[model samples]
Target: MILVTGATGQLGTAVIQHLLRKVPASQIAAFVRDDSKAANLLKQGVAIHVGHYDDTDSLDRAMKGIETVLLIAGTDEENRVHQHQNVVDAARKAGIHRIAYTSRALKDPTTLVNRLMEGHVHTEQYIKASGLSYTLFQNILYMEAIPQFVGGEAVFERGIHLAAGQGRVALALRSEMGEAIANALASPSEGNLTYQLTGRESYSFYDVAASLTKLSGKIVTYTPAEPATFIAQLMGRGLPQLLAQRITGFVTDIANGQEDIISPDLEELLGRKPTPLNEGLTLLYKL
Candidate 1:
């Protein structure tokens, strides 16, 4: 059986939906923290396994009879490493042969976003040490984040921001990530393969702004801000100090163009180009 953790979440739900199309419901199990939150998945015939990353016993029980597992990284910034460690340890105890982990696009520890990804790196190291076959899906920024631009939630609000300005970001549709995850689960690849998953093209904040303006017929602008001011603004929005700082660091990295680059890896895996920014914008606008 294929087990998916965090099935109640956006990416997890999408993955489960894609998997249902290719595999029988009985062959799939969704590991959700709350059973009540998974009523729809249960009604769809998916086996509901109640568990949380912090509960090893629950994880062990849920992982029983499972062969392949998708470890969707938890969103909690603090204590995330420990949470993932709990899942990894339980998966090892359960003797699951293959594991796929969701990770960031780049693993460079020096980058600001890498601070957020440190847990992933540690978890990956543990997974490799456990001797289970593994696949790491290093996904790029989601196109869904673009909506935050219109509301000044992200980097576009301030007049200037710090980043590797010339760098590029290869964004991707979250749905395409689902397709890729399904493919990985259905057919486990030989050895440890890390796919730098992304959309078909790369774009700057200016490009993103142009796409948004075209789609919304509104004049949205990109204004970069210094890290301190950016963090202050995020804190003003009620974000915790540490998280706000991390977000500031990530946006700075993006502005510097550290994450800007497109790879055919996603298209090659899914056998089709990922949805572009304009198309994603149109879909979001219509919704």
Candidate 2:
């Protein structure tokens, strides 16, 4: 059986949906914190295994007879590394053959996202140390994050305000990332591989603005802000201080052109072009 953790989450749900196309629902298990949250999936015939990253016994029980396990990163801002360790230990005890993990595109310990990604990197190391066949899906920023740029509440009203000066980001659609994960889970390759997944092309903040303007026929503007001022704006707009600071720092990193590069690995894995910026914008506009 293929077990998916965090199955109720966005990425996890997408992964399970893609898996259903290649594997029977009976062969799939969802390890979720809240069983009620996955009632729809259970109704669809997937086995529901109640569990949380903090509960080792739950993880061990859920992992039983599971050949492949996908460990979707938890959303906990603090103590995630330890939480991931719990899942890793349980998987090791269950004797799972292959494991897949979702990690960030670029995880530098010094960056704002480092706290978020440190757990992923640590879990990767733990999986490797456990001697299980493993694959690390290092996914880039999702095109879906564009909505975050617009400020969730005022998105349709004020348009997107980004401080990513001239930096170009290679954004991949979330579904594409899910497809890549499904491919890895279906066919376990020899040795551990870290796939740096990105879109077919890179785009600057201005490019994203232009795409939005063309797709929505709405006047969208990209505004650059200093780190301190950006953080204040986000906080004023109802974002928590911690999250606002992290978002500002990530945008600063992008503005510095730190994540402008692109790779063909995503297309190679899915055998299709990654969704373009305009297409993603148009889809979001409709939503």
Candidate 3:
């Protein structure tokens, strides 16, 4: 059976939904920290295993009889890498022959100023050295996150204000990525592989503004602000200083063309063309 960690989150839930289309619910299991959040999965006949990343015993019990485990990247910024290592160790002890992990897709991980990238990098390195066959899906920025990055739907009226400048990202829809991931999971890989899951075309915030203007029937504009000003504005709105800084770093990375990396890997996995930015934006933003 295939076990998917972080099964309650958006991406994990998407994976589960698509996996159910490709395989029987009996063949899929959800490793979740809270069984309460998994009532839907259980109703769908998905076996639920209660466990947390930090809890090795729980992980071991969950890994029992599991042939493959999809290690959804964790959110614990401070201890995520350590927690990921714990899962990897437990998987090894459980004698699982193969594993899969979701990681960030960047041309050069070193150039990142975002602190979260550190966990992805370390986890990848550790997973490689673990002696288990692995499939790494280095996912790109999700189109669903555009709202948070551009100050929400109000940005359609407030105008797009960010430090991203003309930086482009090959952003793909989160649901499409989940479909591709489920496809990969349904047919497990025999050898180690890494797929840079990104859109075939790249787009900038300017493109986003134009698309919004066209789709919403509202005049939307993009105003690139200085990095410091953007960060200060976010902090002024009550975001923690560190979080504000992290967000700024990501946009700045985009400005520097870090997320511009595009690949056919996503489409290849999906068995069809990935959704275009304009179409995805229209679906995500009703107004």
Candidate 4:
């Protein structure tokens, strides 16, 4: 059986849904904190195991009949390293032959592309030394995050305002990433592998503005501000100073062209071209 951690969250839920389409519900198990939250999956005949990452015993017990585990990255950014380590240890102790991880697509796997990639980087190292065959999906930024970067309605109203200058990202949709991951899990593998999941091409914020203009028939613009100015503006909107600075740091990484690489792995796994930026933007903005 396959056990997927964080099965109630967005990415995990997507993974479970796609997995069910390929494999029987009996072959899939969901690791969730609240069984009630997973009522639908349980009703569909999927076994739900209630467990927390901090609880090693519970995690170990959840692995009883599981042959493979997908260690979906935890949301607790501060404690994720420790929590992920617990899951990895339990998977190793449970004698699972293979494991899969949702990692970030980095320009350099050995270095941090940004602060957010820290936990994934450390976890990847731990998994590699665990003597277990692994599949790491180094996913790029989700297209869904565009609305968050440049507001939803505000993007059309005030256009794009970011410190990320002309840096580009080959952003793919989360659902497609989940589909490719499910495809990988269903297929047999003999050795460890890492797939850099990204869209076919890169697009800058200016391109996003252009796409919006073309799709919505409304003129949009992109304003590339200095990192300090953007942080100050975010703080002026009432965000805390530290939070504002941290947000700026992410944009700063983008400005450095940290996410500009376009790889073929995503299309390879999907057996078709991933969604293009313009189409993704249209669906994202409902334009």
- Which stretches of candidate 2 lie above 4 Å from their native place? 107-114, 152-159
Give one digit per residue, the lDDT tens place, for model 4 in 1-287. Answer: 89999999999999999999999999999999999899999999999999899999899899998888999999898899889999989999999978999988777644443476688989999999889889998999899899999988878889899999998999999999999999899888769999999999999999999999999999899999998899999999999998898889777778788788899999998999999988898898887
lDDT of each: 0.79, 0.81, 0.92, 0.90
TM-score of each: 0.90, 0.92, 0.98, 0.97
Candidate 3 residue-wise lDDT, 1-287, digit = tens: 99999999999999999999999999999999899999999999999999899999999999999889999999998899999999999999998878999998887778887757878989999999999999999999999999878767788679999999899999999999999999998995779999899999999999999999988888999999999999999999999999989989988988988889989999999989999988898788864
Lowest summed lDDT over 10 consecutive residues: which window, candidate 4? 108-117
In the order shown, what is each candidate's alpha-carbon RMSD?
2.7, 2.0, 1.0, 1.3
Q: What ranking of all candidate models by lDDT puts the best one first?
A: 3, 4, 2, 1
Tens digits of per-residue lDDT for model 1, 1-287? 99999999999998999999889999999999899999999999999999798888899999899998899999886788888888888888899888889987763555555366577778788888888889888888888766653353333333223332445678888888988888778885688878888888887777766776776666656565666777787789799998777777777677655567567888987987788878887786562
Q: Candidates 1 and 2: which is better by lDDT? A: 2
Off by over 4 Å in 3: none
Candidate number with the higher TM-score (2 or 3): 3
Better of 3 and 4 by TM-score: 3
TM-score of 1: 0.90
Candidate with top lDDT is: 3
> Quick one: ranking by TM-score, best first?
3, 4, 2, 1
